[model samples]
Target: MIFTRFTLKWGKRHWALVTCLLLVCCLVMPQWASAHAYIVKASPGENEILVAAPERLTLEFNESLQTAFYDIKITGPDGNQADDGNVHVDADRPHILETGLQAGLGNGTYAVNWKAVSADGHPIQGAYVFHIGEPSGSPAGLSDLTSGSGSTGGPLKWIVSLTDWIQYLGLSVILGTLAFLLLRIAPTSMTREPMDVPGSYRLLWISYAAASFAALVSLPLNTLYESGVALNELSWRLIGSALKLTSFGQIWMLQILIVMLLAVTILSGYDRDRSIRARIWSSYGSLVLVLGWLFTHAMTGHPAAADQRALAIAMDFIHLIGAAFWIGALTAMAICLPPLADKLPSKVRGEVYWVAIRRFTAWGIGAVAALVATGIYSSLIILPAPVLTSLFTTAYGLVLIGKIVLLIVMLVFAWRHARLARAATGSRLSGSLKAELATGAVILALAAVLTHLSPGQPAAAGPYQETKTTDDGSAITLQVSPNVTGENQFEVDVKHADGSIVNDLEQITLSLTHLDMDMGIYEITIPKNDTGVYKAEDYISMPGRWNIKVHLLTKTLDALDAEFEIDTTKP
Candidate 1:
């Protein structure tokens, strides 16, 4: 009866303490619920590079962006179709959209044009120039790179890195502590060291309870963000559909694995030979954690095509594992330490926990090392600007820097606690250790906020321009030029014939409209410039989709209107 009452009283007090800690964790972390802007870098700075008729052209963004919104166009000096096929996203980096142009682009100015929407749902359009030193005899279709009118915007992408950070830190604290308790910390038993401590159940309950909550909440949040659905109405169907579309669906499988691991542990606790069963169950749990790494994060990372992909993957793996260890250990400490500290012999308790912590310290060191090295390498690949500038200017870079700083502080606190705990001075040392743990709590909160930042998209200037022109005859020609000073010239020539031209037509008046707007429409009087030819010439400012409406009115012909779409390139 006394033991039962003691357990109940202890549980009440400790649960209250942990509940407060959970609130503290939530309070310190800031939520980023909206989209962030990013700028992917361009070659030779937009319109500044001079290529010697290179075989290909490339454009890069600030973040590991998606290419669905990508658009590209290339036209020759004579306003003729020099592009062969439609533009396409690079198979290697979906974030990289590219297209091939016809060969033998003569030495005259050629336009290289492009437009795209960012992951944040913002539309970005621009143009650039690259000169082929001297025009070649290669046919236009040799490398068909053309643009058309019927283009739709890419699906909107959401930023989930902030939530990922929160998940990472929380998992670290919960898992790291469990591993320590199972593998290193011990309670005295009849013939062997007991992996289970008196209050360990409470610790596991709190850790797993919180973890389960995070998993559940993150699921809906992730779903809601991706589908643009309200959280309350996010149905299984929506989730299923989202999973089929995006890689995040794998989390559902991971959640199931965790549940299975939990079930095995619970079942083993009731077995006659609990010790053997417990070990088996714990090993299964560890396996689940490892698999969790594979199913969720490893699957969601940047395209694994770079030469340093292996290194980046390794770093991300270690970083995640280290996070799990840290957060897991903290959760264990919060749940177990307060209730059990007074029950065990001072010397024995100190030796056990200190040894466990010593083991953990090595793991922490490795995780930190991997996180730093691999993180830098990863940043170099994705973030806009040079490595140094990205670290400070970009949103992703700032968040990483914040995480690194907080981690350093946490390490310092750990070092101080290690020194104090190593002395084995009993209660006074425990007090200090608890204080250090408080700092760990703050560190976890910071990590949660860090997860929300989006990488890439650095601030940069746009070099895009647009122009419109209409022909008096039935045929309308629109020329798009990317005024890149140092690069090759690009031009787009559009032709429209609505059977509205007549031989006796003396004058042809044409008007231009760009995307239903006519603020700066340029007009062309046909048959005059061409000496009886019925086409007009005008310049398009940038590379992107355009709309042109031809107005046909001849001296003896009825008025006719026709609409057509054209994608111009930047030269």
Candidate 2:
């Protein structure tokens, strides 16, 4: 095979040296990983009732945001545009987004809708409402405004995940197969003529082609994601703007360029009769290009947003290479070993299998060590000690747990194969090798999903409280305990003007409306408790602005209404 012919003539010492260097690279540097951008502060503040209309709307995120493909708008109670329609990031602070509102705004509720791209290229968006003077009901069709606009859900997310899986799989195959041929097969077969495994070479080509195609496809997908435009609305001009303006687009372009160069190098230098020095140079050159390609993946992922960005990126890079070395090499062995074994004499084939298995076992040990070390560091960085308890409860953590489980299964298979190799029975271990490769594929798929999910933290907990005065001068205090996206306790206390509890109401009816999406109204009746506090328990199905309307009826057939807005968040 052309790829096998380009394998480097490195001994055991060289392999050990490279492994130590990677370990040093990981241990010497460390940083805290940061996930997608979220609102840290807002000008009008969520659910704040203002005495006067503000001239501008501003939002600040926890991290610096991308300049390209961001939006900030304000809509009035009449469902018309309230902002000047010119949104911009602050010149001095890239994390802050601001937009000017129209002059002489009327007194009513207003919704601030925003969308932004994080530094690591993930798209994040949300909506919140702040009343200009008093809480009137939300504007008509307000819920339909930004519905399904977030890139976090829908068919686009699944498509992005699929592309990520393909890219990871393809890169693993390319890097792993090369490592296997150079470290395991070439050293032992140097004295013999090179093995003519056409199937093995074909696999490498297919992987390379797939990786290249995925890299190309990701360009348009990323454009769609960042720009927040419909698929049908995507144009070459928008794509060009994204490529020229965003960090993600630049990194992707660099990766594609490297892949093209790597392809050219491989095709132009494929000669079986090349000199030893030329072969060594070609092998080292290809290795550098492949490592560079892997580096781009690290640069555009979560690690790039870490506090200690350089070290974090280095660790991520090493982690990816280790995965490729283990999973990719196993795949190569599954394809190449059987064919090579069939072509040799029975006695010679048994000896070759034993030697190949032993060498691969050594490589596996090093790869596993690197994977474990890097994996632990990444886990700590992504899920800090404070949030470690949420590991099994969160989407990111659950996917990580699945990957760890598969890794354990792969280790068991490796251990069994190692035992056979040590006993000189490695020739019968093809089934175990295939099983390990299949498990690794599942692990990679889980990893793809993990990349798309935001790490979970302890949900923000507290009572959402508000007080309003009815037309009759009665004080109405409403409180929703732990106002998150789940079941919550709603307590309403009605007091006379003199501060004594009023226990004469006929009944208390509570109406809940989701201000972000049109899920319809949810009504609940609150019974007066022994303490004279009207209370009820109900569920808040999703995260967003919620309007709770309280109706109180006196025993004399008199009715009074009070409304409170509660901003419910995700748990």
| Tens digit per residue, CA lDDT, model 1, 481-552 | 242212222222323355432444455554433442222443434553323345433334323334555555
TM-score to native of every candidate shown: 0.52, 0.78
**Candidate 2 Cα misplacement greater than 4 A, ranges:** 1-32, 140-151, 184-187, 190-198, 272-276, 457-571
Compare the candidates by lDDT and give the number of the best one: 2
Give the candidate number with the greatest TM-score: 2
In angstroms, the error of model 1 at 494 is 37
Error of 1 at 58 (Å): 15
Candidate lDDT (C-alpha), each: 0.47, 0.73
lDDT of 2 by residue, 370-481 (tens): 7877787777677634446547645677778889999999999988777666666534446777889889988888877777666633335467988999877989999998
Could you report the Cα RMSD, in angstroms, for every candidate shown? Answer: 16.8, 8.2
Q: Which ten residues in a row have the lowest lDDT in candidate 1?
A: 1-10
